[model samples]
Target: MPESATLPSATTKLEYLRKDLEDLRYYLDEFSAFLPLSVIIVNPQGFILDINQAFENLIGLEKAGVLGSTVAKLFCEQEQFAELEARVLKGEVIKGARATLLLRDRQISRSLYLSPRHDCEKNIIGYFLGIYDISENVKLTEGRNGTVCARTIELEEKSEDLLRSRAALMNILEDVAEEQKKVEQERDKTLAIIKNLADGILIFDPHNVLTLINPQAKEMMQLDESSVVGKMAAALTKVTNIMPLINFLGRNIKKVYRKQLELKSDKVLEISAFPFLTGRETLGKMVILHDITREKAIETMKTEFVSVAAHQLRTPLTTVKWSLHLLLHGNLGAITAEQRDLLMRTDEHNERLIGLVNYLLDVARIEQGRFVLRNKNVDFIKLAETVIAPFLEVSKNKQLNFKFIKPREKVLPVNVDEEKMVLVIENLVDNAVNYTPPHGNVTVSLSFDKAKSEVLFTVKDTGIGIPEDNKQRIFTKFYRAENAAMASTSGSGLGLFITKNIIEGHGGRIWFESIQSKGSTFSFTLPLK
Candidate 1:
């Protein structure tokens, strides 16, 4: 072997080592590119030797510009960075230590993990540092803490509102409970009053179903409350005790007022019906039954007394009338002019007394239900003419303008009692002539309603009209208006009462319309059949 080839020259060994170093640097760059965390290599002097792409992005700087920079210049906390370096040089590994990374325009919070790099001889030469961004995590933790505090405050406020609402609701519930108690008490009191009331009471709903029947009502109707209540008016018609009332009311349940209903021959009741109203709404109906049997019996006795008294005086009055008539006409003996005049006046007085007695007898017969009607078809026009002929002279004497208005179609006939109907016309005509003032008008009209098969007779007179307070008793027995009594002392106050009875007996209706100080109109309707 040649002496120069025995061992490689020193220059040749240097070139070989230089190639190995270049290969090692290439491998380290390749390994750092794959690492996810921001990574940097620091020399023993604390200067940055190299950095990965992740570290360049975190510092917003290029790796070429950051190379050879002091590691402490990249961090805001110099003292902490120095501590981390010293600890790493002493062979202690550091992990998750907080540090702030400096950028060109801003700062970034980061967690630093440092580990010392060693040579083949196990001697520390440099440090490998890994960094993690903690800026977003720190912001999220602070936000979460603040959110917890705000939520606690909101929960407290909601709890306070809930307490206030609970108290208000309790007050409302207490008030409602008290009002309900008062209502129950009032209902109990009302029920007690109705149970013990003398008058009978029945309450019905709008559907006409009986809802409540007081004890008095049950007793008066002779019915059990369980069986009668909750029954419709139509269904109750089958009950014999209440049938008459149901039939009378019919469909006019709200229109009845103080109408007489005879439950039996010995029992009579005055019933009134009214509605339960709330504002303009009709809620239901209420019926009240009041006993009137005793009143009717008393009235019957008084009528009987009047009938007997009138009967006893009738014979004597007839005898006096005949005796006075003979004396006035000179049938007994001749008399002087003065005596004749005196007897004429006496005869006039006797005639009036006889008329009163006849009126009383008619009233008695009417009250006893003995007023029989002999109905016959007769020309009412001719009858009215005959009755009016006698009144023409009397009206003329009073200086009254008397008019008789008759339908164009004559011969209007009606089925009625001839004698009683003649009396009715005479009574009406005589009253008009007597009561009317001089120069006032007395109109008698007769009309026929073919549609209704009835005849209407009207006698209107401009007389002393009835007073407002005295009008209700105008047709009652022995009842005289204040104005009528003041106008004449001779009125018996029984003419209208008799007239009404006679007219009603013939299936007719009579009514009068009068205004005080104005005038009066008396009208009547009679069925033709």
Candidate 2:
């Protein structure tokens, strides 16, 4: 190493190194041409040295438009780059930093990173500014125009919970409204039922205020059309402490109470007061007052009739039984075979008469609403087959084709009083078989719809059909069709009436569709579950 060799190459080497450094910086700036982030080079003297294609796009300006301009020229006057330049000169690196820069058309907000570079001698040159468009980010963070990741998830959960709560509340409201409507309807029905009785009804609120008084009550109290409502019961009918006592019974009595109240008309009114309860809420008191004057007379008349009929029936039955016994035992005389046969027929008729009396007694109990049913789950198809077996045998003798078609799906189970349902089916099948003509077909089919949970039992007969005009009256007690009456004058008309009551008790419906001179199809539907 010669001293001359180092000294002669110093100036030339400096020029070459400076040119190489400028070329390297130029290439570095060119490398940013395809970058998505904007690139800007700023000298320590606050001058913009160069910019890339991204910078041109971000500012919406041409490359030549921003050449040789100060960095401050690309920003608002308020956002000058004086402090940023000072920081770069101090050798600080700002990564992922942000700022708002202004252009001709709009203010461009961006995230920027600053990197300061120097030569081998350590003289500060310029800073490389990497900028990302942060308009969407800023809106999401501060401007409130976009959804953030965390906030979006939270809002979604809250919205779901809110929607579920709203649906539940709506269902509750609908259920409550439906229950209220049912209660109102039941109340109206009760009012109508009690008003039809030969009694006076008065309903009072908790405060002893008269809420409702039926027409009978008004008549008994000598009240005009608008006299009783909203007035105290004590004031209206001079029944002191009656309303309060009635309210007390409604709320705290916990039992039905009966008392006698003296009406203004000098009549002793037998009153039965009961509480009106809806769910767990107690509404008020209901008082029913029966005059009992005409009812007492009717009861006396019924008692006299029972005594007389019983005595008359007992004497005849005793005489017939003794006479039949003597004839059967051969105690009276050694009669001929023909005479014995006559005596046996008389005994049979007497026994049938006694059976009729027993049947009438049973019916009387049922008509008075005292009959209790032993409800059980029964296979309806089997039950129907059992009840129709006898009728089918009898129909065979009549040369009527009796067909029982089992349902494809085996048996349908129904909850009902087995004995009562058996009686009903037997009567209906017998009626059909009796009315059907010779060589006619009596078909019974069973079907079920699983979706509706209903079972349909149909009995179709090819016989003389009923008339359309008499259909409604067929179910009435002691009422028989004209054709039926003419055909079977010995039958009691109570069979169909009892059948209807039994079917209704089991929550089933029975109806018949018939065409005159064609046939009749008697169909009944029962609940599956």
Instruction: Report model 1's TM-score to 2 decimal places.
Output: 0.66
lDDT, candidate 2, equals 0.69
- Give per-residue CA lDDT, model 2, range 327-390, as digits (tens): 8889987888998899899888888666455444435545556556788888887888788878
Could you say which candidate leads in TM-score? 1
Best by lDDT: 1
What lDDT score goes with residue 196 in model 2? 75
Native-to-model Cα distance after best TM-score fit, residue 296 in candidate 1, in Å: 0.8
State the lDDT at 152 in candidate 1: 60
* Candidate 2 Cα RMSD (Å): 31.3
Tens-place lDDT per residue, model 1, 165-246, is: 3333333333334554576699999989988889999888888998898888777878888777888998888878877888
